[model samples]
Target chain A: MDLSPSGAWLVIVVASLGCYALKLAGWAVPARWLEGERLQRAAVLLPIPLLAALVVVQAFAGDRALVLDARAGGLAVAVVLVLLRAPFLVVVLAAAAAAAVLRAV
Target chain B: MGIGAAVGAYGLSFGAAGVTAGLSTLQTCALSLLLFTGASQFALVGVLGAGGAAVAAVAGALLLGTRNTLYAVRLGTLLPVRGPRRLLAAQLTIDETTGMATAAPEGLAGTAFWATGASVYVLWNGATLLGALGAARLGDPGALGLDAAVPAAFLALLALQVRARSTLAVALSGALIAALAIPFTPAGVPVLLAALAVVPLILRRRRET
Candidate 1:
């Protein structure tokens, strides 16, 4: 929230460049090196935890405190929708709606 | 076409989320245009929106983007572009395009890849702009429960990647670590520490070998 406008722009530029570089590296690097089982496993395994961490931090944490409010309800709905194999947009919107409804009541 | 439409709709949320996270609309659009990766873009904005430092936000996002490289590696072999065209191929080598390309009939793979990538790019960027503008006008994102939407989006992305018991185990561990770390550590650090969840798996594998 305290982020300066320039700071935000810097993040946009740096992160975007880093991501593009990673994508290009994939194309340039030899397939044999990346195709190794261990390296491949690391790649596949890495994002799983990061994403899971994000889910927890976003849903449960509140400014260095774990406080569950409407977001939890929203996330619960998201879980259910995901289990039901709902579309990506549906899952996200349904979660938001669930939270809004919970907060309203 | 259907994939593009679905992804485009999701882009609306990204745009809205970026604004909610405190980015100017131009900054948000810049992310969609330059980063072009859905989960990483969301992670960056999500971290920034939550008041995390820019360094942490960039770290989390860059980590998330690494998977795109893996996608590119496979696509490089399958498609085998030679020179400057490789730049376009690498840029378009995202999850959706890779999925469509890999799944297409042998003769139609190239067509499928280009069509899906280009269409999704257009639709997603257009929708991101729309969502960002609409959200900027809405006022009070909490009233609409948009705050919760961020986590929900992450959950959806996470759900897609969890197919094995080990991956699920890792996910749960990551969640626990992040939740535990939140109260003690800084905002972005918890997510970074959560990546430590893999240590147990690594140790276990080491023991087996």
Candidate 2:
């Protein structure tokens, strides 16, 4: 099959290697340093902001101009799903349906 | 994390997107197999679909991947494997694997990590192929708002992380950053901002007794 140029494959290889390097760096570092209190503390708290930023980006990025489009409508549906504690599958379907309908209209 | 199912479903969307963007099934599968990161893969495809340069898309994907560096640091110590095994372990170290593995109790960490990663890998790639084959019939997944499913699923994952004491602050910070950045940065940048927002909290914890 004709792929999108061999260069794209190279991109995949490099990206994969780069990701692996980061993963390996953790073990490659000395045990004592990694196990230290500072690192431990950082790990414990890192998720909060990382997750926060992620949520922010997801919610508002496309709404940049703040035009109330289907994406925004879908996001509202997602908010409701979270509030209702809907199952993941349910929430996803709800949001996707909302977006699809919005797009169609 | 239970987000594995959502991730798998999203892979279907990605597969469909790949086909629409002129990628073949083998190419889509290769993308999933090699660069298993969802957000980056999506960004790359989005860029490619938008007629952006392949080189630029690759660069954007790499930059977005910087956060995995932090995951490596955090999870590497939790589940240490030797040389060759380390390669496979790294391949499996996505958000779900790292989050589930790190949170699991001592003896169960390894098992949880492997299970989460392996499960996501299989389901995601399988769904990708399915999506690719059915791309024509699948229509617009975004039109169906399947795209929102991921963020909603992620929100559910976040809810599971909230404890009684810090739940409000954590949730607020995430919301605030997401809201603030949505207008400014691109898709992945907001996630980076969210990760960065936690740095102050980490610093505060360090200063405490």
Candidate 3:
């Protein structure tokens, strides 16, 4: 792959700064603002959908249409492991193994 | 737990991608250490891989990173830093760290949050360096479906977050937005959209009480 050195560096710098800014914004803001009843309630519930959407996209979206091949299998295995309340290490290894098998076969 | 593992593994793939994108081992490690944001790093590399303009890729990453603002707010309260600790704590703040911290029982929240953040930082940078060095021998992560690891891991994380009452609405909205936007948007954009879609639901839920 042909990567431009200067270009990549620039992206890294800007992205890092942007990330820092977001973190700073939260810290710099007054605590009372976020502690409001309504915002607090919203915060508790917000990760659900945002994380759900991420899961769906990761499991299904492919270069073409949705693929239920190896990736999906890996996801399924991870889901089962999670249900069983397995340790994080086991779940990751199992998911990766499932994905590898599905992709190979 | 699931989200942490899955998201962490995604770091491995990002490491692999970083190597393929012509980043050296040191540079890749630096990226993970400095940026520490998976979505942004992935977006940066994805754009490079696709021959997209560098500036556009950076912009895409910045846009995706907007969600961290939300995380920072929640985590700030749970693990408020004082004196010089603030600087280190701020660097450690990420989705996983913040999530673990915010979810933790009050007294234990600070410790759990720091542990999670430190662990992720160590694991991510270590894996990236390893992946960069091993990329050649690794032989096609796509063929191995390593890319799937990210979404799979994220899904597991999402599953853990589900509870009663609001589960249906949150799940449906996330699925709808992700499915619709995945094809149109770039790598980090879908996550941003997912975050944006939740805003109205959050606002509406607030109004109900």
Candidate 4:
């Protein structure tokens, strides 16, 4: 009952179209509208919160209940690497290794 | 162009996760080619991987995608692209391309955008296929801790953007909202609703100056 092939394809199609529409809509927005501080601030601030939410959800989700295990350790390792300004690949591998090692023990 | 491999690495994780989440390999590759943003693609698969409803997955993905619209708006003034080229520019308006283009000297922004975007597209799609094909052999990404890749990747991305005080505040509040909602809401709903946590701060800043 998860995303089937057909279902996955549908989401891809809709997401592509919707994403394009957002680009077009951005152009269509009047310069006057963007002149408003609130509208502009919301645009800038939106991803910060949204991506944080994604990080939380992805780190903790488990079988319809929230739990933390190796994933948290992985996320923490990622935080340290990222703060150290590790390259993107380094951050990913170290994080995966951290999680894998934690799960192994 | 060298940075396209960033997309490659990110795409590989998505491929593994998408397949684990029950999407076919073709389906996962299609996502990389079509939707083309790492965060949104991850949001869509993260939900489905958890066996959450498809509607919830779509909702979360689309909301995350709205950020691309802001990127589009920011790029418009810089690029001045029009007609068919505008569409092409829009497709290329992901984080890497925008960051590169924005950082370029005034006249080179367009070149930076295209070069970065095209390289990412080619490498990312190819890596997606590789990951999808390899997924079955890899067993559970969760066991390998590949599941943690999703959140860790998001944190890495957030680390880049959270330098500003306002952004850090929004991120903290958003995390709080999502953490609180985890017990009460469905799997993907916390992410979608967490948008509300930032609204007041945005509105308040508007009132401030």
- Candidate maximizing TM-score: 1
True contacts kept of 3: 0.56
Per-residue lDDT of B115 in model 4: 85
* lDDT for each residue of candidate 4 in B19-104, tens digit (9 for 90 to 100): 87778888888888888888788878877776667788877777777767777777888887878887777777787888888999
| Model 2: CA > 4 A from native | A1-13, A36-38, A41-59, B1-7, B10-28, B37-80, B94-119, B132-136, B160-171, B181-191
Query: Top model by lDDT, which number?
Result: 1
lDDT of 1 at B107: 73
Query: Taking candidate 1, what TM-score does its chain B reach relative to the real chain B?
Result: 0.94
Question: How well is each residue in B1-209 modelled by candidate 3, as lDDT tens digits?
Answer: 66655655666666766765566666677789888887667656654554445665666566556556667777776765787777677777777887788888869988988889888888888777776777656777666655555555555556666766567577678678867876787554554566565577667866887
Alpha carbon deviation, residue B85, candidate 3 (Å): 4.6
Q: B1-209 in candidate 1: lDDT tens per residue?
A: 57766787789999999999888889899999999998889889988987899899999998888888899888876775889988888778788998998898877778887888898888889999999998899998998999999898899889889999999999999999998899998888898898888777876776787
Error of 4 at A2 (Å): 2.3
> CA lDDT of B136 in candidate 3?
51
Q: Whole-model lDDT for model 3 versus the true structure?
A: 0.68
Over 4 Å off, model 1: B202-209
Q: Using lDDT as the measure, what is the rank order of every candidate, best first?
A: 1, 4, 3, 2
Q: What docking tier does model 4 reach?
A: medium
Models sorted by TM-score, best on top:
1, 4, 3, 2
Off by over 4 Å in 3: A1-8, A36-47, B1-27, B37-85, B95-120, B183-189
RMSD for all candidates, in order, please: 1.6, 5.1, 4.7, 2.2
Best by DockQ: 1
